[model samples]
Target: MTNTILGNISFENLAREKAEYPRLHMLKPESFKHIEIKNFEKVEKEISFEIGYHRGRKRWCLDIYTHRGIRCDGEIKFFSSIPAIREFIRKEYQREPILPAFNQKSATSNFNI
Candidate 1:
């Protein structure tokens, strides 16, 4: 099934869970040597969110390091009436769209069909 196939993907497996709160791990700083991220930058805006439109009552924050791939992104939700941030984070992690896989074999084909 499509869900089974998708669940097998690495990114889906990396999705966080509510019980995984306070998730913290140190990444090798060298991985980010090529990308520059200044402090106080808003990285999640580059992604997507449904915050604010429902009301001025929702907020979320994300911290990211460009090199360790999607695993480096951290999310935090802010609101008194909603589910914990970890829940939303896990959902986002699983649903984040990814580029299609590349196929070198297909790239070499020149047939017009």
Candidate 2:
């Protein structure tokens, strides 16, 4: 898979497209142009919430990849605003979504919210 874009998403383009979310603000401008990320996070097989962003013709929102069991069984859910992403991150990840160093140490941080 390519490294600059995750799936069909591109953070650099997203930022230029004014679609970047708070979690992504941690990255350097150059990082966005070359971001990549793991599709899923494994932690004791608990429910996982992978955040993503999208801007449609009439709306701009966040995407949440959710799974409680099999990773393949996960589903991508869309939220209408960034606050929703923040709330989910706090509840599921036990941290604020806007924290400065959100994914500084992760290999595939493109999908981090």
Candidate 3:
């Protein structure tokens, strides 16, 4: 069971297969006005959050909001391959190395991204 909203929200269910910056309609718009794939673009929103992948660091960073925004202050960072990003979300950054599932041919699991 996930205790965080990120864990609760399904990126695939949001229907963002083609969107470079995927977002969702918040059930309760209070916490997250909007959340999308973080990029270099400049966005204008009161409660905007971003999730990005850093190739250099080989990790993911989830920045909640800017200093001028409503959130108090904080950021979540973790390392995950493009395929394993789901695990990062499911585990909420507390991820261990994912081994192959049930003698699968590859390490990648069948998580619908």
User: Considering every candidate listed, which one attains the maximal lDDT?
Assistant: 2
Which candidate has the top score in TM-score?
2
Report lDDT (Cα) of residue 15, candidate 3: 33
Candidate 2, residues 1-113, lDDT tens digits: the string is: 22243332333433444533322221321111112235774344334334444534222344333343455344555665445666765675565443233333242343333
Residue pairs with clashing backbones, model 2: 37-108
- Whose TM-score is higher: candidate 1's or candidate 3's? 3
Segments of candidate 3 deviating more than 4 angstroms: 1-48, 65-71, 91-113
Per-model C-alpha lDDT, please? 0.29, 0.39, 0.38
Clashes of 2: 1
RMSD of each: 16.0, 12.4, 12.9
Residue 7 shift from truth in candidate 1, angstroms: 28
Segments of candidate 1 deviating more than 4 angstroms: 1-77, 81-83, 95-113
TM-score of each: 0.18, 0.33, 0.27
**lDDT, candidate 3, 1-113, per-residue tens:** 21123432422222334433323223322232333345866544444344554435545544444344554555655544434544654464333422222233221133222
Which is the better candidate, 2 or 3, if ranked by lDDT? 2
